[model samples]
Target chain A: MSHDLDWIAADWGSTRLRLWAMAADGTRLAERSSQPERAPRTPAEFETILRALAGDWLERTGTIVACGMLGAREGWVEVPYRPVPCAVTPAALTRAPVAAADTRPTLSLHVVSGLSQATPPDVMRGEETQIAGFLAKNDGWDGVICLPGTHTKWAHVSAGEVVSFQTFMTGELFALLSEQSVLRHGVAEAGWDADAFADALSDTISRPEKLAGKLFALRGGHLLDDLDPATARARLSGLLIGAELAAAKPYWLGQNMALIGSDTVAHPYAEGLAAQGVTVLRADADDMTLAGLRAAHAQLAGA
Target chain B: MSHDLDWIAADWGSTRLRLWAMAADGTRLAERSSQPERAPRTPAEFETILRALAGDWLERTGTIVACGMLGAREGWVEVPYRPVPCAVTPAALTRAPVAAADTRPTLSLHVVSGLSQATPPDVMRGEETQIAGFLAKNDGWDGVICLPGTHTKWAHVSAGEVVSFQTFMTGELFALLSEQSVLRHGVAEAGWDADAFADALSDTISRPEKLAGKLFALRGGHLLDDLDPATARARLSGLLIGAELAAAKPYWLGQNMALIGSDTVAHPYAEGLAAQGVTVLRADADDMTLAGLRAAHAQLAGA
Candidate 1:
């Protein structure tokens, strides 16, 4: 759309598509987004959805580097997972299948491959890019990189390669327990109870086995003692996150850790880690996603 | 109704109603059941449901003794919970409101009071009856009763009373994780993999906190390793139940444990306990429910 527009950086997830119009100098010129009423059902529909989001920005014959679920099996194209004990960004990018209506054939589309771990069996889609971006910024940073969201990830990074990583369903568990489980009767949708969170976190972390047994108390506390919904909500969050921290202890203990997320989802992880005497370096999640995409796009532009 | 039908035994839960027509000699003369298209909404609707299920059995001026969600606040009437450190059955039962129907004023409805604990704040609706029934059969039994279901209960039964208990979302978590979570993509509905269940159970029981981390492996293993769906299903069940067993170690360790339920649901719990070297005494859940209701009815009749 502009004379300075060089390429596009995209982060395509299951529910939304985000595009960043980038200048030749790597500065973000403009940005656009679209949350379709329904998820794109066909591979061709993904292209249609992307075009609608970044039509004007697609005027030039430039490359688009994307990450996230767009590389998933059901996405526009299936990108082979670059197994861990390897570089964050793959040596090659998977090209999206071009549709017949392509006005600019040279306007190529490339997706970054997700990372997978073999021994314990784990995989991540959009997160691999963020890890790459964080590593790009802090070159030679050898420690754990945590990307917290629906499926929170912890990676052991060293020698500029992800040695190994693990994924935890902490955030998803909090959602299901607070909204879908019997705890739904006691937990409020959006509420804060800081003390309750801290206590529950400490309680579960020290005695992690009690996690499953303690869940029903949320509903019982409400029914029998009229426990506050807000407190119950915070406790539910603490219980799940605390369990994750207990399991991820090996990843963060005595290791420099960088948490890539904003206050919304990352604060708790930061606090949880801090409680264990580990100071967490933090980065904004959006910046990291774009940075990762920019890093991948730079490779394509260089090639 | 048969002339021998003296009193009725009912276990009215959320989705279904079960009625046992009983003779004066404590024999179950006949039985009937109904799974309503919809859960009963009004108090009158519950009575209407019972009538439809046992209309002929309502011929005489006798009593209807019941337990379960029919005693929940949203059920027929709110039965005040008898706090723990007390008898399984209170001296008096709460009577359901008599509707305007004039057929049998003497045919009263007596609902059992659920039990509650204050320290951890736990409550039980229907499981208390099963515990009571098990206690009646093995008088002076001083161990634990494991009732595995949607919300599995592990109760400490001593001195003919429930001293303490804990409720785990293990069964419910298995249903949600295997049927609703991302693991749903890889798990089978009705398949069996015994070894997978055993190994997962052993792994998690030793390190219960790893649960949140290991769930994604179910999906990843399927995608990357062609892990069988049946094994995935069994692994999911084992993981949740293992975590519960670890949390409930104090309840079953070095204690006589009786598992109440048919093989469909109770087998895993029994096996898990057996793995821990605890020989589990087994009982049919339905029989236990009737025995508890009969114990209560015996009190009413003698009174």
Candidate 2:
């Protein structure tokens, strides 16, 4: 069983680590994860953690390709960001300095560098790998790809390279506002109101500046009109997303667009964009991440 | 000292009750306050709380003029909101039914009703009184009175009546984003950078819709460029306020403006407005609330 594993793919983020045992042909054999008390502070620590998670599968020398925050300056090895207008393939992967004194000769590690745009000064790590996966499938697709999550990103991929990208804190803002702000008092923990969401999305898209005032009205409406908490929650979600869409109009306006995120998270974006008469293709976030890692592995092997 | 007191000017809000012992001519003789565990649920409870705070000032039967959330529907008694395009005086004040069984016949209480806008369906419980106070001092002033706070209000006054007004959740959003959102990690708990504030304010005002994206940059800049927390805090503040100014352009453009809020809270607004070439007069928020309540008392007494 251990011999079936030929390499490893890992997406190590700020808070969690997810690893996949991959065959030489890019087939995933098994998966595992670890909740490190804290992220590794050095290459040795990273090696130790990696060995602990995939040691059994490493019956022979194998290549390990990693992405995500692991490439950040604070990660195991600081990989400089690759300026954009570049392909999202492993050809762009930057190798972190290997531990010269590695005791485990059966392991080789390489971390992928993230993409950065100097003009707008935007940066992305794990999402770049996902974009690579998306482009791998689309092959020469020229348009926009929106990855909605904690920090939703919109990347313009043209001629098989990511031209430019922008990010919005829409998800994080919604979480904080719904859980910590005054709106927390009125927003329900769970439920959906499609009409409320659509109405609020339209209202915010039309007058994004009113966002500041409209937020308070969410609470006031609940108090005065007995607005259902679920509806309030949906409306709040719509408002934040709508504001984002308004700002990101430059990216999605008159372009072929696709959304790469969890079904639940990406549904609203689809609905919102559709309401504006824009068709958006939805793809699974995890699948894209896996495909991205596989594409990186293929490039690394070929190189 | 208590004998000189003629009437009590009270500003009872959601959290605290503030009362000023005033002479018949509006001379503030003394002040007192109380923090009720919960807001009053009935007229009798309101009277009880009022007596506890200023029973000593009521040597003889004296009228009490109250404003703020005490007049809210959930407060002492449901006071109907007086529609806009009217004077912010006792003429719009609604009398809450006095306790007929008051053991102490030395107190008569009247709560001022807040102003509401039907077109936009907005309501204000406390700021109207502040507007009244502002108009009291600046009689015949036909411009904007910006009361900056948790829910900042920009009211247009002409010929002693509030012509129209708008409220922005600028202050509240600033507080929530800086303290609760991911930006909290990068923002300073306390500090200021005037230049950073000015730049961010200008940036957001020019591209208000970019607010969703610019917010994340606060954290990114801190991580990438070693931005000082103090500067980050100020920039965050400027961004939120700048967005507000952009939305409130119609209210302040080519108009004289006065700011009514605490020094710390109002300073940023004054600075932002000043940057836009609008000179704003600043007044103490507490003083304005008092003056507004006093004006209401004068009107009630005349009636």
Candidate 3:
């Protein structure tokens, strides 16, 4: 069973840890994850999780390349951020230090470095690996790539390098507003209205200053006018994304664009960008993440 | 102790219940509150809290004019909101019903109705009372009364009537971002940087759409540039408030403006307005509440 495995590819974010057992030809032989609910914390936890998922294959594995918050200060090891206006492929993968008394003492564990932008002072972890996967496939393709999540990032790509980028806390704001703020009482727990989203997106895009005022109106609309929960939910998403689009006009206005992810968060950006007359290419986030990890694994052989 | 008391003034909000023993001549004989940390919930709790604060005065009171979310649908009693384009004095104060078997079943309790704007879909619970107080003192003051708080309101007063209004979730957003969002890591629990705030305020106000991006930069700045926590805290506040000011430009651009509250929230609005060349008159929030209650009390005597 371990003969088919060559290296392990992992994407460890704050809320989840995914592991892929890979062959030398970059084919995934097996896949496992600690899902979003029960991700690892300390180095010991990471080791424990890894063994539980791929104990049979790891001892026979030649190398392991992990990406995302696994390299954060609070993670297994602190990997330095590679400042951008640089290549998507990590310049170096630091060997993640483990305890000396570890059972798999000779484990060749390495973590990818995240990217940093100086002027806007933005940083991205897991997304960089996804971007690397994207660049590896597209070669010299140049434009912008948008990866949407809690902390959504918009990167300017040129000549195979992440030239510059910006980030928006849009997803996080939407969650907090819908679940924690006074508006929570008015917005329904589950539902979505595309029309409401389009209207709200157009409203905020035209007048982004009205963002705060519009947020309260959602509650008022629900209480006084009996706004549908679905409408309120979609409008909340629309408003935040609209504000983001308006701000990111410089990045996506007339630029060729690709939106990563097929989830709810990415759907709106697709709709929002399409409304603005942009023909956006959509990519599956999971595939890109795996491809990114595979690209790193293949690079080690050439080096 | 109850001899001088004629009416009882109360301002019951989501987080606090304040009580003021009043004389027929509109004087506040004594004042007390439940404070922000622990407000009342059910009708029984409200009564218990009232007795704890002013047990003696309540027995001799002729009128108990209470204001704020105490009248909310979730409150003890749902005192209907007085739709705007109406006089500052509530159209009516619905008597809050006490349980038949209660200790003071005949208690003359009344909760002031908040104001509602139809077109914009806005509502003000406690700020309406503060506005009434301001109107009572200023006579025919006609302009915008900017009340700063979790849900800050800007009311348009014309000949004592609340012509129309808008609400900004500015303070609430600032709190959410500074204390709960990723930016919380960069911002200190307490501190202010006026210069940093001023710059961010100007930045967002000029380009309101740049808000979501600027927010992420606060965290990024702290990480990359060793940005001061105070600066991050102030910047978070400034960006939110700046977006609000931009939205409220039509209300305060060349109109007579008065800002209610003397605390952290109000200070920034005053400075932001002042920087825009508006000499904003400042007023204490508590003083206005009592005055507003007195105005309501005085009106009761006339009726």
Candidate 4:
């Protein structure tokens, strides 16, 4: 709880909450944490938890500027989304003026708004703002910036703002298909075969048209005669990833792409896109999000 | 029961069993049925059920020519698979003699051999002989024939034998994806939109690469937002069918494809293929299998 702090920021999602205290120079002075918004805690309970984690600093600092799911309607505090085609600056964030429970109502707080894409209404919760933060840091970047996670975001970025993006339920589908479907019989317990995965990716992308039918080739090639479950499992994985690549190709057209995420999440795709004649720059995820958050906080403080 | 009958023919699968009494001229004189070979009936119990269904005819006919899963290792009787790249014919299906009952050795029987495709080693039980019978009835006809059921088979036919084929695990995947996946969220409890299905087929075939990505769009369009479940379910259904169409395309290139199965099974695909600019001819399942069986029986009889 440093009195000299200029701002506080948080990135909230379905499973985790991260809070940061910053100096005017945007150096993180301290950190706080809590379970995700879905945690079995009421807004008051979560607020107490957040205060317990960083409340002392907040009392001393007298203000905080937070972003992410923590600011959503269902969050510890409700913040409505700012509509699309807006920049991801602190100014772009949707906010709520609130008086904290203190001897004197001293803390002022604001939350960022999620972004949406279409009439079909593809929207992001906390990550949209985080992405906007990333754009804020890397000015003049133009191309696709993929934020891969459970729900992978493939976005087109230009002139320091997210222009357009699509979401692929890749990790979730992989979990469901591999662990739940009858195809579960073919998956390996722990072992991974890079060759098999590459083969599958190639098989899927090369004949994207035949991707689904080829899935059965796993069972067909394994049971009732062909018994190659590993290949089959690999092939299924490939089909999904290949399908993602195909859907993502349009956004990456004629631009340099930066992949910002864990290598485990982004490497295969980088490998896949490389094969497709696309140059991809790989960056560390924590660095990107934190930098973006700092940039957003600094931009807001400056404003 | 016809005293003049020479033998009885049987078809067995995972869930159903069918039998018929035929004269030398292939005139079907009587009908009988029972639970499929997968049922818990012992050899004696199978005989009892068969006799109960057509015992009198068997007594008069004195012989049986049984096929399908009835001959698999796990069935009432084990009939080994005949390797592929060979004519699927009655003579090819001829097996070692088996007594209808240990106590009644006079009742003799022969079982049919199933067919197998190497490389990936896909095998078909019972249906290969039926297909052989079909080829015998319409000798020299070459094209694609679909045997649709819970698992639909699309086989490429040439020179009175199956040249190559691929199976669409469509039916099973549909059941698994709809009933089991998180997709169960917006799916209709039990209704399908034909218009939605038609659109799915078109989109699937047209943008085969987008198949996997579109599935996520189901939950993404609905959960993180609002969506029509029926249309969403239809979209899921279309995504799958589209994938199947993409996989099945290579086999149908520049060929006249005929769907040989029950009307209920073939019609949707017939409509789907029509939309894809492919003309399809339909054939009756019973007649085709009977024609196939009779051809096999006649071939073995001549030998």
Clashing pairs in 3: none
Pitting candidate 1 against candidate 4, the one with the higher TM-score is 1
**Candidate 2 Cα misplacement greater than 4 A, ranges:** A1-9, A12-24, A29-65, A70-79, A91-110, A298-303, B1-25, B29-65, B70-80, B91-110, B299-303
Q: Pick the candidate with the highest TM-score.
A: 3
lDDT of 3 by residue, B1-303 (tens): 434778888888778788887877777778887664455567777667667777777567536888888788888788888898999764357777874564762577777788887887888898888988887778778888999999989888888898999988887887888888878878999988999999999998898989989999987898789899998888888898889989999999999999998576789999999889999888899999988888777766677
TM-score of candidate 4 chain B vs. the reference = 0.83
Scoring each candidate complex against the real one, what DockQ results?
Answer: 0.79, 0.45, 0.80, 0.35
Q: Model 4, B144-249: lDDT tens per residue?
A: 7777666677777777767776667676666666676656765765656778778877887878777656765665566556667777766676777766776777
Please give the lDDT score at residue A65 for candidate 1.
84
Q: What is the lDDT of residue B12 in candidate 3?
A: 85
Model 1 agreement with the true structure over B1-303: per-residue lDDT tens digits: 345778899998767789998887788878898899988888888877877777777776458999999889788888999889788853336787756666454458898889899989998888888887887788878889999998999899888878999999887788787777777889999888989999999989999998888898887898799899999999988998899989998998899889999789999888888889999899999999998998888888778
Top-scoring candidate (lDDT): 1
Task: Say which docking band candidate 3 falls in.
Answer: high
**Native-vs-model 2 lDDT?**
0.83
Candidates 2 and 3 compared: the better one by TM-score is 3
> On DockQ, who's better, 1 or 3?
3
Clashing pairs in 4: A1-A57, A221-A226, A222-A226, B51-B55, B68-B126, B71-B79, B90-B296, B133-B292, B134-B292
lDDT of 2 at A91: 40
| Residue A206, candidate 4: C-alpha displacement in angstroms | 3.3
lDDT over C-alpha atoms for residue B264 of model 2: 93
lDDT by residue for model 2 (B1-303), tens: 544768778888778999887877778778888898976888778878887777767665468888888777667777888888888754467777776664766556788888877656567888888887877887777788998888888898887888888778777788888887767878999999999999999998888888887887876676667779999999999999999999899899999888898889999999999999999888888798888888887777677
CA RMSD, predictions in order: 2.3, 4.8, 2.2, 6.9
Candidate 3 chain B lDDT trough over 10 residues, lowest sum? B98-107
TM-score of chain A for the candidates in order shown: 0.95, 0.92, 0.94, 0.81
